[model samples]
Target: GKVIEGTLSVHAKGFGFVLVKKGTDIFIPLEHMLNAMDGDYVSVEIVKKVPKKNPEGRIVKILTLQNKEIIGVFKSSKEGGSVIPSDERYNNPIIIPKDSLSSPKIGRKPKNGEFVVIMRTGWNENDHTVTGKIIDILGKPESKEMDLLLVARNNDLTIPFPTQVNKALTGLPEFDLQKELKSREDFRSVPCFTIDPESAKDFDDAISLVQLDNGRFELGVHIADVSHYVREGSAIDKEAYERGTSVYFVNNVIPMLPERLSNDLCSLKPNTDRLAFSVIMEIDSRGIVQKYRIRETVIRSAVRFTYEEVEAIIKGKKHSHAKTIHLMQMLSLILRRSREEMGSIDFDISEAAISLDEQGVPYSIRPRERIESNRLVEEFMLVANRIVASHIAKKSTKRNPKPFVYRVHEKPDKESIQSFLDLLERLGLKYQLDKEVKSDDYRKILDIIENLDYKYFIEKVALRSMTKAYYSTKNEGHFGLAFDAYTHFTSPIRRYPDLVVHRLLKYYASKEKDKKGAMKGEAATLSKKLDSICTHCSEREIRATQAEREFIKIKSMEFLSSKVGETYGGIISGMASFGMFVELSHYVIEGLVHVSELKDDHYDFDKEEFTLTGRKTGKVYRMGDSVTIKIKSVSKEEKRADFLLV
Candidate 1:
């Protein structure tokens, strides 16, 4: 193959791999790296090929450098200043020129040990060190604001809305109630209400329940009509598309759209009439949708209830909207059962909710409690998304279907499934998993291990076995939700795909017979363009997810930094050749237990069993094993913690 081009993914161990589009990654030895850093686009030639082993390659050319901006702590020396990168993968410190302080446009001078953003200018081949100039000085190290800035910069998240985007917002006209209502169905009389987090600023969706006289239920799912204000090809829309989705950090939110829209115009505030794209469904007691209609509508939310409030109502502790809450609870249960019957797997992993003090410092990390209120909103949103997707799929013919974005999840690879089964066997779990397993097979294993101590560990493994879900122009269906066709039809304010779906729905709804046929050519053109859009959106979404996780990790480390030497109960979440990862029971943070810390005996790692076995003592530290560990050290720069077994 003529020198294939791919993105280089670097490891902390000096070597890296070039991930090509259509095949296995090509491993590049350290000597053949050709100065290419992580996330760089490079052209590589396969130099060594073995039948079973990974193909080794040499980077022939670096097409583009991905990490042009570096965020790190500044260290001033008598000779000159340098930056120690937060990401340890870049081993060499970036040499900062003394002239950086004289440049007023580069912002305030960075003090020693303070976080700074460096614009990589060049590299010194002789010393193997990168050179850069300090562009912005972030706050002091270990500060919450500095942590947020580092995470944002490292993930390439755009923090500020561009001036042009903000200007575009000014020209956008306010929702003319009388004019807009003329074109949209009026659902103002519907007893609709929004359920969201207590601290949520943007309420993108609302739910309403009405009991029909004929013993059926009408469910109204109203999503804010963001497309009305953010027109396609506008500055705001382009920025939103580039962002792909809103990123929610522990203490801050980087919204995809400006506050002028996301928080005000697009937010479905209670007692305020708002424009929305509504999905109204009529279903029987069994959660089977008898009929449904999707249309542009105007709705007035009667009330706004937090998840806690709704949960309280469900539990009969509150009387406000008790009837509606009961009806929603009933429908949600039916929907859950129906979905479970269809082999939908529910991996209810606990997510950490880091509690922050007034100064934005993390004080505690606890598992976020999930209640019926959360499930109610989720089940309704799932049904709405599925309904919208089915509508598009039904209207679309293979020859001339409207171009649409789908959330696709392909079946897991056979190798991954076998590996998971092997893990189950090693764990001594008596569960049967076939080579060619279906969704139900995994569900059965999960059910059997529901009450086991290793349930979460097994759940993580099962999740790892499946393919990651992504956006696509073609409908491959969603494996996790067990849906034949699915699109993001809700949360347009936060997600770009949902906004695109809304636009497509409007375009198709307005097309006449002749125009519809003429639009076939446009659809074909759109289908081709959607491939790039899907890929970009998927990549951006991953970046957002990583930033979110990094923020949480940073906060967790900060929270544990003050408690070094204290012992805590934990479970081994992962294993490696060097050490095993232990996640504390009370806190969601995970730390490394290096094999050297097993002072009683020398330990050897068993790859297949995922255990650290002591040669002399015959003691094993395996995945899901409970142990007590004393915090040895915490590195905010490395964003990790080290633990010593007690």
Candidate 2:
């Protein structure tokens, strides 16, 4: 029998009813419910269906448990302690085991107010409650930062790498690193340079270009050869694979590889010999790649240029190195042409990079934008990666295709795109929504919004209407980059997928041409496993993105904490019955302006028009409307920013 699927509705009393599929709701008796709580997906067995009565069903099994890890404030009665979960959906206070509780490490235990991470152990249906054990005390609930706790709890992240994994990394034998460099091609004579952000520690990729005798350019994309340092099946390799990607929190970075490899040996520091997997691309002035080669190379970087420095060079700043400046100019022009020809979506999204002082207090909130130097590195990497992917895909020796992990981006959902189209139509923007939206279409939209005085709100809405790119075994190509095949062959130090691709590329290079056909079976098996890893990596990417957003939100609130009652010009980003979200002009920090504070007339939200309209007055608060707002309050503990209508 097919078990009915529905959400469970529990009450403050000791019982709840399961709303079964389209039929009458079933009564899950308090005792018969076992450990099932509200909002749990339970596989229920239909016990009885009587006439004119609600169906009675017994829980056969628990399909899924909501809220795997709970974050809450700890409170202790004389008998024991319990956690009041942060989410109101699970209002039940979970009892904490006494043995699992310990006194606080830093100070006298927060007897009745410390925050902690609790894992649900069991639930008592008779009491309509959940029982959990305090795994670890996070911090004081009133601490300046509560966002990290929320991030860890929401993602069920565990601190401290496994002991065995740590021991493996510590006990690994040091390879003959110096001797291994002898076999690689030496690029010490070339004027290789690294372009990165000023705050960056992990330098992964470097570029060097020279005009060839045949009027073509030889562009070298040298990546940090992480595979050369971290041996296969080693502890470091296993740990890197498990992490999949680095986690970037507000003030810190939990890297994929250990510091010894990622920040030291694998880092392509200037004026030092470093191992690299090099891609030599022969491209014409017309931005066409004529031929390319991949090789094991050793390079000494001559210079390290920040994005700011590169941007200066592009703007014809009188730099000492004339040749490098000219190359930068040529590269930018080439990239612009390539981007347009490929219909690549050139978007301008501001990333909030907070500046912090020594004691971890927020100093300032800065918005970083992509400059010409950023595009210089981006274009070279794209050319390098495309050459690698195309080269690998073109080989026809094997029965089954060679397995390489690719960064794939699927097309956006039609319904979501249509919604954005409808929004544009309402805005009176002449965008062709009925036709397929390509990179060119995106470029045109960006241009349209850029020229308009109210471009900020339009771009914000446009951003909300797209899909995120992720890793996959099957290359659907990258829609954003407009590449038929794309793979992450650079930045192996930070990204795990790139490391995997580097290892695969090296393995292919090591094999004899005659034996390539025989390697298909093993490659196929790895491809299947790589696919699973891609999904896991993609999910982790989402988690990382959310964590980054949460950190930014916290920093944004802190930045405005000092400016309470200060009024600033803001644009409405979102609107709801409760309040409207207003993004400040200078800082771009969005805070809620509660509806209760809005005087003059009662405003009702119109869902169809996506606006809050005053019934009595004709004033409207639409998505892109600008308004004056005063910072009312900033709550670091609550992770919220509140504003008042001026």
Candidate 3:
């Protein structure tokens, strides 16, 4: 058996995969997992290799343990029963000792089928049992609010500030508007405004654009100065660091900061003297940044416009800021053109906007409408973040680069890119593959498929083949954005990395005047803390994204459950040996139509072409092929759907 080390990704069905660096991920069956938890670093031993399928592996050792909160259903007996985990990824049942039968929250024995949380004390290798005690009993989810509570507990997200955080909040001052305005650059008179979603409450960033006398444009991107209020090492800052970023659900949000600061104090509210860290850039007519300055400023936002309102304004509704909006749109177009020319890969995919009723039942699902107004704001923020990152990276050497958190996306691996190219060739679309893949290669293919009927199918594959973006202290350069350096600096109210970057920028700016202070081992002290911070923030970000995606899938399944047996138009979005996934028209909901359900004849799967064809009937199913389907079954708990081919 050949041994290899990689992170384990467990599926809900108990099977798992270990993704090594060089090839397709190795598979591990349910019995071979060795009780390894999802997301655990493990050593896997390859036991069998099957052509056209991933190699099968057995877990040889658990390299690292994940201290995760446990939630499960309790089954009690005299000798200490067991708990069945709500998450199906846990292959083994957890044992609850007789003394652990009594719940701490209720101070009573947990009845069968009651949802309870457990704290794992240790694993009993002698008995091969995972031992734990019941910590809290979450009563059965009888209502939508209780369901929300269950979701929050599973994800470790909570509302209202902690006691220590609130205590630190009291120490913050009620800034004197007069005194604050005198200490920094004043942008109160500028026509600055915020554009965000209609449901947005915490306005973090605002923009001010002016046509300079020398014919260059002055663009001011002002972000909320959260660091000014929440000092480093404070309780509030520590809590924010733990959160990493805000988690937005279908009906609620777990904010990174308390509402007092997120929505009121640090928010760039209109007609208020708000503290801001501004990035002022001077750009020529061709969208080239001529010069820039970073400064702490006091800004009074003039208007807060929603994306819909801005779109309406752009379509000729009369308003005082209409001219500014139009100019910003013109500049955004130029910026986008320049970015595309620089080989920045833009994946133009439509995000699903799911709407729920009062009872948290999803009733409507559609693509989020993207307009010129959205792009205008996005372009400004991207430029500001890029400039902030480039300023530090360009000035320092590779060995002594400033210690900062960067939003980096590394280049795609050759194996994944080769698979994608093979798929393209199978579909009869050919292109020359360079020795090394660049962002521009992806950009060119996406442009070619922009108007093709199979655009969605191909684009999804290309995106899946790319590397995930994460936070890192090293500036490896962002492959997707085609930038020499990049960092997030636009939304400190929602993101912790942005706040840390703001503080670093200010600290370095001050030290520029004091050579001795700048040489005071500041880099060494900061560098020691950065790697862990970046890793934690990246992990939190992935967790938040997973939670958000889970909620959407659950809601989507619930919606589909209502339509069981109802026929709808669908397209084959994905294919596997056993089944094909069909996505409904005008909806992002996908359901698996198993090969067994193909009634006419026995089907054979083409692994390379991803085609399922009948032996006798000659019926073929492939990616991007249209077909009618009916919902056969759906499981909201498992977040899965099955469909019948019609």
For residues 43-140, write the lDDT of model 3, one tens digit per residue. 88999999999999998787766667788888887788788887868958888888877765668877788788887656544554567788888776
Return the clash pairs for model 1, or none. none
Summarize candidate 2's per-residue lDDT along 475-589 as a digit string, tens digits.
6888877888888899888788888889888887777444645666787798898888888878877777776776777667777898998889988989888879988877878
Output the better candidate (2/3) by TM-score.
3
The C-alpha TM-scores of every prediction are 0.91, 0.85, 0.87
lDDT comparison, 1 vs 2, better candidate: 1
TM-score of model 3 relative to the true fold?
0.87
Backbone clashes in model 3, listed as residue pairs = none
Rank candidates, TM-score, best first.
Answer: 1, 3, 2
Q: Estimate every model's Cα lDDT from 0 to 1.
A: 0.87, 0.77, 0.86
* Evaluation by lDDT, superior candidate among 2 and 3: 3
> Predictions ranked by lDDT, top down?
1, 3, 2
Clash tally, candidates in order: 0, 0, 0
> After aligning candidate 3 to the native by TM-score, how far in Å is the CA of 132 from where it should be?
6.3
lDDT of candidate 2 at residue 251, scale 0 to 100? 64
Please give the range of 10 consecutive residues that has the lowest summed lDDT in model 2. Answer: 102-111
